[model samples]
Target: MPTHYEGSKKERIALDSFIKFMRASESVTSKLAHGLADYNLTMSQFGTLEVLYHLGPMCQKAIGEKLLKSGGNITMVVNNLEDRGLVSRKRRESDRRFVSVALTEEGTALIEEVLPHHVELIVEMFGVLSDDEQQRMGEFCKRIGLAAASEEES
Candidate 1:
């Protein structure tokens, strides 16, 4: 649903656009999260695993940056994965402050199993758009995201 506020034209247009964008984002996230439930993983946990699986071992700070998650949230997610024996963290002898996160054998096996389904779901969701349209949409999203980031920094 669009905004019902009786505001200026620019405000009305921006509000409606924001509403649609959020709804679509929520819809996609919800769909993806539903599948995570089957694996007994939260969205954050799955994201952590996926990033570790793809990006290899890295510090928690790097993982947080990649996931756009907070340090505390990343810590919790890593802790949960650790409890499940899906990942491990090791501190370098030289610099104990630098702990690297990596997928264990079980984690590797699980993500290998899950990634295909995840990709399929993503393809299905975006399949509504043609290749060109999807490309254009990605560009638009990135541009908007950059603009928003700059706005936030100002």
Candidate 2:
């Protein structure tokens, strides 16, 4: 059955494109989340680990910014990782009030084991797209993200 939308042609077209974009994002993320489940990690936890793995220690606030997560959400993720002995927070010598979170040896080892497989999964998921199509898609996403960020700042 064809779904009918009540809107001007341009508005309906824009809405249809937005819906497709969001559904594509959700579908990709759902697949990736299933892949991470074998390691008992949520997407947020994996994202945090990936950032700390590549970028070294960062404060909770910094991690939140990098993940585009709220402070409370990041705190919860960090606490869970800490409980699992995958991460540790150390107070700064110069500013004891500020604590930086870093991956533990266990965390480093875990990410090392999982990252390659994770990358392979991503590659497999995007294999339907030609290299040029993937590149163009990336460029479009970046442009959209930049515009959204600028709107947020205004």
Candidate 3:
């Protein structure tokens, strides 16, 4: 079964493009999630580890901001990672109220092992697009994201 929409030409174009964009995002995310499964990681877990790996120690609030996750959600993710001994949280000396999360040695090793293959997978996924096309697509996405963010702010 297919969805059928009756609209003006511009409206139809916008609807079709939005549908395709959503489908593409889902497809890519699903593939990546499957790829992460062998490591016993969810997408959020991997994202949290990756951020800690690259950014060093950060407070939970800052991590949530970087990952665009809610405070409670970030706390849960950090708790899970900490349970696995992949991440550790320490109270800030200057601010005992804040806890900073950092990758453990084990976490660093795990992400280092996984990141290269993940990059390869990403490259392969986008291989169908020429370099220039990829660049143009990135630019277009940035513009759209910025506009959406601005609208949210307004």
The clash tally of candidate 3 reads 0
Tens-digit lDDT track for model 1 on 35-134?
Answer: 8889898889999999998889999999999999899999999999999999999997788878999999999999999889888999999999999999
TM-score, prediction 1: 0.93
Residue-level error in angstroms, candidate 2, position 104: 0.6
User: Candidate 2: which pairs clash?
Assistant: none
lDDT of each: 0.92, 0.93, 0.90
Model 2, range 1-154, lDDT digits (tens) per residue? 1136788989787678778888889999998999999999999999999999999999999999999999999999999999999999999999999999999999999999999989998999888899999999999999988998899988
The candidate 2 region of ten consecutive residues with least summed lDDT is 1-10
lDDT of 3 at 13: 84
Top TM-score hit: 3
Rank ordering of all candidates by TM-score, starting from the highest: 3, 1, 2
Give the Cα error of residue 144 in candidate 2, in Å. Answer: 1.9
Candidate 3 on 32-136: residue-level lDDT in tens?
Answer: 898899798888889999999998999988889999999999889999999999999998899898888999999999999888878888999888899999999
TM-score of 3: 0.95
TM per candidate comes to: 0.93, 0.92, 0.95
Q: What is candidate 2's local distance difference test score?
A: 0.93
